[model samples]
Target: MNWMEDGMTSIPNVLLQNYKRLQIEEKEMMVLLHIYSFTQKGISFPSFEDLAERMTISSSDCAACVKKMIQKQVVAIEQGDQTGYEFYSLKPLWNKIAALFESDARGQSLQQAMTAEKDLYSLFEEEFGRPLSAIECETLALWIDQDEHDPSVIKAALREAVMSMKLNFRYIDRILFEWKKQGIKTVDQAREQGRKFRKPTGTEQVTRSENAVPFYNWLEQ
Candidate 1:
């Protein structure tokens, strides 16, 4: 029976129909859906291992499917000696597929998009109280776009690190490294550590005055 007879009028079906016109399998439909979902979310395209995990299939199977899609010209795969594989949709074909499923007028206005990005930058400056370095700014932008990590958790860690270490970026880096080594990615871990360090012990009470010297002076002594 024809796919239309089966009443499956989804984007994937449209994509499959396009591929079949070029003599490809309907199974490519599933792989295209997976790729569309991944890219639509603005995440870094998944690695082969990631695709395997998400699809609950073996890596070899995932690789085979990818190769077939590439061969069929429904997907494009780029490989770099250093950077590994990147997958991009054949945009013309995908657009046609999407148009079949729904109207294509769902894009954002340029002004609204720019305003949102500007707001994020403003928030970043307020949180850090200084302009982000280029690399830091790029990292935050990627995080915001992908929604991969929690901004609150990152902000709390930054705040605790700054407060505890007197805003020394080097010390903050060290603290972040240690937390990462311990698999502490959330804010609560940093807060708990800060609380522990701030607790007044008898030794701390007795030696507080003596240890109040500047870090450089203490180092010199």
Candidate 2:
């Protein structure tokens, strides 16, 4: 059944959330609802005559209401198409909705960013085997964000330090400095470079390794 036959149409409540404050009169509101109904039914070119014929409004009144809607920027019309008016812009509606919700959207985005930063802090603590000091946290952030180093590369450097039994920030810094000198900017490159610098595995090799000395052992020496 045609919607016009039953005089039934549904309007989205959100579109009319500010309907009472729209600065349009009662008859104009009725015309706007008619436009909504026609648009929902896929009738791009709605007939003002048919609308006026069904309602108590005259065709002239309905036309005047459409002009008012266009002036208010609530509706738009394109002139060139043979369909009389082919384009109807809902930009005004979009502007209103964005104004209503932009703050909430930004708040959500800020919260997500803060959560991610905290997560990175926790990850660094776990990897470093202790709570990060303020300066240490800043250095980690600098590597990831300012220096544009990948977090995985930083983690690989951390793991490299741990494996060498020199789990110190200064040791990690040395690894980063060496990789930077070797043009390594990613975990894959770091791994390949690690392989290039790896020593032979044996008791004799361990005895010959410079990395066999811990940080505290060097201080005591």
Q: What are the RMSD figures for all models against the true structure? A: 17.8, 8.6
Candidate 1 runs further than 4 Å off = 1-121, 139-149, 206-221
Cα lDDT listed for each candidate? 0.60, 0.73
lDDT tens per residue, model 1, 1-221: 68556443235555555566545565555555666766655544666676676776777877787788777555776554687856565664675456644542434444565565676567657766888898777765665456434455445545655456565445544655576666766666656665676666888767976677553211110
Question: Which ten-residue region of model 1 has the weakest summed lDDT?
Answer: 212-221
- How do the predictions measure up, each by TM-score? 0.33, 0.49
Best by TM-score: 2
In model 2, pairs of residues that clash are none
The digit string of per-residue lDDT tens for model 2 on 1-221 reads 67457566777776677655557678887887777777666775687896797689899989998898889777777664564657455567557656657767999987986676677678668877789998998888887678766666777777777678898878988888888888899777876676667645777577768566542211110
Against the hidden true structure, what lDDT does model 1 obtain? 0.60
